[model samples]
Target chain A: MAADKDNGDQEMSGLLKSNFGRRDFLRTSAAAGAVALAAPARIGFAQGGPTINMQTWSAAVDTVQSHVNAFTEATGIPVNYGNAPWAQYRESMVTKFVGGAPLDMMWVSDAWLPEWAEAGWISPVDEFDFLMAYNAEAEDFCTNSMTYNGRQYGLTYYTDFMAFLYDESKIKEAGFDAPPATWEEVVEQSLVMKEKGISDYPMMLAMAQESWLIEFMSALVFSHGGRFVDDDGMAVMQEKDKGAVEALQWVVDAVNTHGIVSPACVETGELSGLKAFASGNHAFAMVAKYRLRMLNDPEQSQIAGNVKQAMMPKGPNGDHNTVGWMRFHGMASQAAQDKARAESTAKLIEWFGGKANGAYTFQKFLFLDIGAGFGVKPLFDDPEIRAAYDAYGNVDMIQAQQALAMKKDVVTPWFGEWNETNGSAWQSAILGNTDAATAVMKSAEFWDELKQDY
Target chain B: MRRLFGYEERSAAIFLAPVLAVLMGVAVFPILYSFYLSFFRIKLTRPNRTPFVGLDNYLDLFTNDLFWVSVARTVTFSVVSVAAILAISLLVSLLLNQNFRGRRVLSTILLVPWAIPYVANALMWKWIYDSGYGALNGILYQLDFIDKYMVWLGDQDKTIFLIANAFVWKEVPLATILLLVSLKAIPSDLYQAARVDGAGVWQRFIHVTLPAMKPGFMLVLIYETMMAIRHFDLFFILTEGGPGNASHVLSWHIYVETFRNLSFGSGAAMSYVLALVTFALSYTFIRSLGRKV
Candidate 1:
């Protein structure tokens, strides 16, 4: 007993005298931190949750969780649900995929269809007849957006197009009875609004270098009757009279010459533009159609009751065309290798992307909650859905504009690489660092280079 | 007689094995792996098609116009940021070193900006520099300094400086502490001797104080230069190398090349180049540190 006590006392004295306690605590804390950091970066597989793992950008989190809970209760399959912020979602997902983190299903943007499919990060869902069957019900545009290399990847999460939104109060106050119908008219009305001391910068265009830049530019180019790439996937945007140059030139003149759009528009992002427009500081803005709901929400919008949508202004040689974009649920290629996990993932995807309880429950919930455009034709005719649309937007105008919305011509395996260059080129033109023609040409050259390399 | 442990050297090696293994795992492995990856064409999009492309990535970057532009921007940004950091920290440290009341509280409070993560700091600055509803514009407008809420970050001419400002603010605290340490280490007898030599405050500062700060200056110079050269979060959060690539520095270029373009080989090559430059800089500073003050 004395010997044991002596050993204990000696050990205590050594620890205290050498400051081993502090060192041990720091060492243990560091180990704990390393383990903690490694844990999340590993696959989303967890101890208590269901075997099926689903990841998404944080959007409508509560609604998604509720649906997940219902699915778990009904199918007796638990799910591990996780999400990152929308801005960082793509990088997070890419890192997860490259690190070989186990992902069963996750949200994918239409723009990434070719890249992800090429990387073998995601697998085609055509093998599942039940999921494929709903493609017939989906709009051809949405369905086409989801397909790459003749393989269908997944089902639609939501779909929307860029729309021309105006503050009704601002336009009316600026002595405009109708919104501008052409790019020239847009400049004229904006100048008038500016001259009259109404809106300082009467036009809001988000020319910031981000994911949304390509869409905004595409909409402009398409409406001006320009194609970024030809049917053979060759560069056409660099052509002098092609819509790209004209669209870009107009934006440059708007910022530097007309004084209608803020030079700061080059720094403005889509969300920032939306908030600016809602704050009633601009007479006109170009944003995704779904933003109309938020622009008209009394709690969030300063110009709630007076926000209205108009057809995208036609460029000099172009029609009122716009860019359409969509997001879909993707099945990880790894998850498809195991038949059991495949079935569980498919059921979960179906539950969210397709019919839930045989009633398109998830789609209805998503559309109603967020006002995201639905791909199903049946939902368009639903009275309640139509009424919700009528409250915030013109149903006729929405259909007419959406009909002209085109998928971005730049979608390819090398789209991500090309997009960075293209976005910078456009911003360079807007900032007068380069002329419109050079910007368009630079974008075209890079696009072609990437195409050849890929 | 047989002993439980091996030879002294062998026992030391055995004891060091775990730490060496960890260093190899975390640090040495990644560094070497990236260097190896720099030799291949590791496009993530074309994962199955990685062909060893022998120094081509480096050649392409060195030849590219955009790469040169990014290098120039990085140099300018680093120089301006480091200069600002060194000057401001020197001033702040001198003030904080004094035996004033609330000195401790003030010194502790000085770390608030340094304590915040660079990302959080970037976000705060983003709001402050916002074109609309920005506190910068609001305060300037209220002060009658400007007739309008002028573009700040969006102004291509001023973007690098604005980003540099935020970076310098976050970096100054650590540099100040380092300077304060140097000040504390200076012998009081030196200052007394200078006074006895009929030196005034300015002369004493130049003769006694400045020379003693050589080590601190060396530390601050090396650290801040490396940090400023690689600083990414502010540019990413604020401009994303825009208002037309005005703030497009080498670090952003590497990020765009790697993550956005998914060209890991080229990204690795750029990183290795940066690492080499950093090492050369540190070596130069260390050599200068050994010089007479």
Candidate 2:
């Protein structure tokens, strides 16, 4: 009995001694762990429902889940989700629509709006008064997005506009005080950067099919004051402006004359270009704002702090134009619930655009450019958030400049049929089968013929 | 005792009913439904917009340049890939039939490429063919074999060839394995007898092994052609039929027209056309091989 009592006492003393010795250390670790765990808790409280479906980019799914978790915490909602890559998402959406399956809501690219609306697949937002309530206070959100054809079809959750990301250290080493302010300067700086061996290449633009060319062409047309369509929506290729043509010539020269970019640019996709820029192989890359998150991740990036984002350079018109790509979430046509439920869902959309939620979603999922109609205006007002945008130095300023100068794509009428045609023309041009002028001209003619039938 | 027409009709019915029911439910229904859909003006996104258009969908497909072009490409691709695979497999099988050192190790290694996933294999080859900093171009440049990089999959004219190369590399291994199995099954006594008669390696192969492996060759031809016809992943990952639709096959056209464009009627109609072409080609191939074996 005495021996047993003595052993218990000794065990108690050991526990006490260890606790005393590591109190401070254990306290700090416990606090850090709580902060980490708090993220999921916050998510649970924000989302009130048991589940909601979302169709977001595969790359951005994790970032979205964090927000969804926070939403659940705030509102006691649960989220059951499915995700698809951007390319496959279109196919899946079509399949789901055709099969008449159960779907609550899905991410809709702006390019999909006209088709979805014309097809009558998406529900009208005007039926729910929640949008109007939010629109009154946040006019910027409604005007810039959501409002298609005078009636709002959906709400914008996030937007990403294209911009140039530069390695400031490399550029400074090349004797440039600031980023190239114009297209001419971009070319000159690329050559200069290449000559000094600061970087083996000056600029990297994604020239692959579908994704990059769509953005690149939009930037060209916008900066050069070329319009793809008239007010009447007739297909017009106003190459007479010469500025858009100059942009095309710049791309051609970047390949053949300047040789600043690697021939691999023609083969690289957006994600690959993001990888290359984050690896410090290229000094500058034409990319969207979303790349910032990947660049910031220490585990995935080697040049984390060395890179910065900036607006794409301007043309002779002095306007640095970019292509603004926005994604909106709309209720499925099959979701014919009560008007009150839709109003509640509409309120959820508003909540997504609300200040706190917007800040959370943008800082988390939207690491690059802020989507309009959300809390971008208020989120940018916070100095800490602004600083985060420029952690690599002046990136925020450059992105802001570009966003201010950005323009919407022409939203081609025949985008459905001839989407692959542009890639074909670009590839043909790159392979020396035909020159850029011929390719662009031929695309213009094709675009016209395509619309003629429509 | 209740047999009719020299058989137990009730017993036969009892055995066949379940199988017939399953077939009707699984196979015949879907085929008939697809055929039914092909006759409508259906849009995937607008399911309610479907209207019976009789033979218009098929007629429209016939007039569609992209459709006809994709069909031609699919046929050409199927023929070249099947023929190349068969030829390479036959040669490899012949090589493997010989008694050689470390033959097992070599045969295993040859099958490794086939074991990998098709998409993964295609991606691996894509990286190798990458014009900028791809391993293949990098090595070629180092060796001074080429002055500059070539976008192997970027140019439309070269894309089909690149895709074909990837397919052949992936497929030849399986064909070789199958052929090798058949070759081994050939009676060694025949070879011994030929040898006794002063028959050389070439003569023994031509007279004995070749005759024994006719069934295997035909099987490879049928399987490879069908596989080549149904392929979507290679073209999807490689070029997506670019440089002006040079590599775009009928399968991809069916996909784009159905989903991307959301014209399900047209997509279904195109798919039916693809199915018919494949069936006809497969039939012709089997017919030409004859049935003596």
Candidate 3:
């Protein structure tokens, strides 16, 4: 036995000498050691049951994990929840999908759904019988937004719409009795606030290079009675009837000509505007309804009780229109390829969006927790849900109505590209790099080129 | 075990296998695959519909005004950033090479910015450059530098420079360390001889130190130029190539085309174009610098 141990020790030493040779090897070994040390601890799960994996942004992870845990507890199926930041979520999803990783479900933005659905990355929700019941409870716009090529591939889990969130005290300080109802009133009231020093910038517009800016612009275009695309699904921002150029010009004029908005508006993102307004520094901000949660949070907001929500201001054309940005829970096509996994994923979807179980109630409560509008119709009419927003004075109801009323624009597969191109032009115009009409016309040509590729 | 090849050859092959595998998997395969994909009309959103469209994608990119604009911006960014990095790093290296008290401690601490992750460094600088409630504006305001806070990122002309400043700050430490190592390697005897020969301080530096540090200086310049040309994270996090494409670099545009637009063909073609430009420029620089060295 001692001889055998000696032989083993000799072999180990020989192996080390062969593999790790001197200074260069030591450096490489040190790097490998550091990498190993930096690696996260491996999490172990029980061995027997089918496991479901869900990917989403980190912001939704906790809420998603809670739901996952409840589903696992009731069904005895293990679940793996993966999350990345909003910036990395799309890349992660695409990598996982292409790599053939077993992803059961994922939360995708509405803008990304068409692309994923068209690519066959996600399965159609119509294959499951539970969707009929689910669709019955969901709002038409929400359900319609998830449908592509006559097939539903996802269910709207959280709904948001653009609304005018304002600091009531600031507006009152500017001698306004009510929130602005027209573009003219908005400019006038913003000037008043600026003049009175109630806010350095009276309005916070999301002009950052992000989807939020595009969404805001879409609302602006819609409010001006403009369609983002023509009936042939071609970009028509250059068309005179659409008012797209006019919508962009108004935003530019607000920043450069009127100077009601500070140059800082060019840096404001969706959340940044909300946070700025919540700091009691702005009279008004055009932001999503979900920001109400942060603005209402006593710990997170200074203007919690002093803020009010109103419908988006009308445009020069007197059009009271806006757009809805929806997020949905989609099942992976790979998961649907297998019978058992498909059934399990469908059940998970039902538990998240279907009205049969208390899952829908829990989902509504979760949306309410974040001050987001739910896609289901009954939740809006729920007295308890309605009463929860008493502090904000019926903003929840207002958002719900707006979500229903807003036009669902740019739902096609090319929406993402179009939005990005349009956003760049608008940003240029806002920054005075180019005129609004010139920017829109140039962007329109780019959009037309992008359309050909699709 | 019995070796199939000679002992030295076998050992060398065994030792290199892992690294070669890693290189092939991570670098070589992706490059070849990207080149292949560039010839096809591929969209990530239409995976099954990819069709062969050789040269069209490249033609489209060359013709596109936005692509050319981004290339120009990238060149401007690289030139300015590389110059700034070289000057600052050379100055720091010179200062740190002196035999002063706490020289070692200062040298160690100087790597803090380099040690921080690029994304984290970018986020910190974003806060510093923030138009509202940023340290830069706050400091300026407190000093009565301006009546109101200036939005540093809002202005088109300043956005690229501001991001370039952040990039230089994060990059200077590595360049400094590289140049400092070269500086330290210069023989004290050379400086002693220079002084004895009646050379002034500036003359001694020019005669004795500069020539000795040429190799390291060239290395840092090449490395930093490459880094600046292919810079992605700093632009992505700080400006996102924006305030209206004012700071849009080639890499950022490539990323937007590839990932955001899901036009993999166009993105890959642009990336190859960028790669060719970088390769040509780097080769030219190295050849010229090699002659000098």
Best by TM-score: 1
Proportion of the native interface contacts kept in model 2: 0.43
List the global CA lDDT of all models: 0.89, 0.70, 0.80
TM-score against truth, every candidate:
0.88, 0.82, 0.87
- Candidate 3, residue B251: the lDDT equals 96
DockQ of 2: 0.28
Off by over 4 Å in 1: A1-54, A65-85, A95-104, A127-133, A334-349, B1-15, B99-105
Error at A108, model 1, angstroms: 2.1
Better of 1 and 3 by TM-score: 1
Candidate with top DockQ is 1
Q: Just chain B of model 1: what TM-score?
A: 0.95
lDDT by residue (tens digit), candidate 1, B227-270: 99888999899999997889999999999999888789999999
- Candidate 1 TM-score, true structure as reference: 0.88
Candidate 3 deviant stretches above 4 angstroms: A1-85, A103-105, A127-130, A133-137, A331-345, A393-400, B1-5, B14-19, B99-109
- Tell me the tens digit of each residue's lDDT in model 2 across A44-128: 4354532454455575565567766666577665655678888687777777776666565677777777667666667767676
How well does candidate 3 score on lDDT at residue B241? 80
- Candidate 3, residues A1-454: lDDT per residue as tens digits? 9999999999989877887578867898899998787552222124424677877788655677787888788776677888889887887787777778879888878777777887789988797876666787777778877877778877767776777778888887778789988888889998877777777778888788976777788788887777767756677777775758878888888988878777877777777677777788788888877677678778999988877778778877737677786778889998888887777777777767665345475556576556667777777667777777665557455744465455355666777777767777888889888898899898788777767856
List the pairs of residues colliding in candidate 1: A50-A78
Candidate 2 or 1, higher DockQ: 1
